[model samples]
Target: MNNKNKRLVIPLLGAPGVKLTDTTLKENLSDPFVQFKTLYKIVERFNPDGIFPFMDLTVEAEALGLKIEFPENDNPSVREHPVKNRDALNEIKRKWKGVSERMITFIKVCEMMAKEFNILKGGYVIGPFTLAGELVGVNDLGINVIEDPDFVEEVVDFTTSVIFEYAKALLETGIDMIAVLEPTAVILSPQQFREFSMKHFKHLSSELKKPVIYHICGNTKHLIEDMGKSGAWGLSLDSAVDLKWASEIVPSDVRLIGNLDPVKVFLQGNPEMIYEKTKELLEKMRDVDNFILSSGCDIPLGTPLENIDAFMQAAKSFK
Candidate 1:
């Protein structure tokens, strides 16, 4: 795998039926061995440049005592918002037990992946602003950011502390990259993102021992320049972003990792369509040296394995 020749294929392929089933998601997330087996199957199947550890966004919130609802067929989601004010936020911080308690299994999974996989093994953490939204309802957080900027800052600061502690633990596990998932930040204006999210992103990027991949779902054309200022080594965009435009705006050093429509081509379409779309995207991004071919977001549950195979084959077949 020479660096120049390597066309990194790092799609989000850890959904049910891509390598495992809903049963695996239900049982294996808490068991390190099961998690490893499931992840190994995915890596063995896709042979991606990097493989993600289970990317359940609710794990941190769950660790913080927020209730989560794990539906049989979908990703688990936070069901409750526990932090209502500064006092409640402080109280949760006081009782914080660090990543050792709830995230230990996830940490162990990362360790196992690092020990076994020779390629890139990445770990995921929910971004501070998004995690803050999980703690206090997103609507409330949005209102507070406008009405009481100080209160919003306090909550985001608390969430950043929690994420930093967890991130340090993940890095200690020897994972090659850390991806900060910040889907919640897409709703904010570019200025608001710089004020609320960029600072924390810079802080985490500075503290990380490895490169940080900043991921934000939905339209982010408005924030591309500000995202570059976050100090992240990579920027992962969702399906709505125009990759060509993003590649032109960001510095050459910042790697651009995605824009494929996971649902349209990978899930609903057949292998031929997958190959065509993958090739189209590769050609669209052909001149961008820092581009890495990948799904815009996590491959949805029930996406056919053959479609993923087509995705990889298409990337490989391209010059």
Candidate 2:
């Protein structure tokens, strides 16, 4: 048994971090290469099978001419909402050059890592509605969806195409998977999810033949069926969702991951508590197969390493 070609064994993790799109880390995202390098190190330390690093939130909106302001400590935030009018869409180039220095640099890191380690190479990207949120602002996009249906549809479709193309490019890079993060979709009613979010998301999933993971940070119990229907291979849930009920809702064919309280338990709980919580959840999953253990959301950066070790210890024990 040679070591180089070996497939490493590791458990899934709810990738943890600060809300970069909020107020920290944004200052450094201006240089995508530096951003990728920084994020990769943190991910490599965790040693998960794959990771969606911090570079996800900015590229699409920034490319679309949104005024992105970076702060010293956080991920980049959108300074100017780009979709004030339909004309602004032109600012985003339709063709993917695979040569955008910023975009290509991220891929180069993945290629480099794939050469060195068997770990999966991956990253995140804003979903259509989320990207649209950066464009029209969250409240404004909601208003437009009801007030101007045709315009919202047009914008969503355009953004959806870019999401698909950009993600398609990443999947072709020999990486294991890409998480299509449609965080805004969590706010929609389940019906709205079926109508607006699921449609394009389904299309996006279909176009990317590689595995896709969807993370909607909310009580996603009501939307699990739609998630299954959307063609995503897996769904990441917030801690608010019920684990037992979710296992029943998700189709057996599609793997369901998560609902650990990332902040309450992982951030504040002790290792024994972490072990207890993980043991309880894993027991709940006893009746189901195809479930990957994970946190409901990104594990807080300050999460106790002991708790993390305890959680992984439980996973490694799984037969």
Question: How high a TM-score does candidate 2 get?
Answer: 0.83
Measured by TM-score, the strongest candidate is 1
Q: What's the lDDT for all of these models?
A: 0.85, 0.67
Give the range of the ten consecutive residues with the poorest summed lDDT in model 1. Answer: 15-24
Report the C-alpha displacement of residue 246, candidate 1, in angstroms.
Answer: 0.6
Model 2 ranges off by over 4 Å: 1-46, 90-101
- Cα error of candidate 2 at position 102, Å: 3.6
All candidates: CA RMSD (Å): 1.5, 4.8
lDDT of 2 by residue, 168-251 (tens): 777776777777778888778788777677888888888787778787887777787788778887787788888678777778
Instruction: Please provide, for model 1 over 86-115, each residue's C-alpha lDDT reduced to its tens digit, 9 standing for 90 to 100.
Output: 889888888888886558888998899889
Collision count of model 2: 13
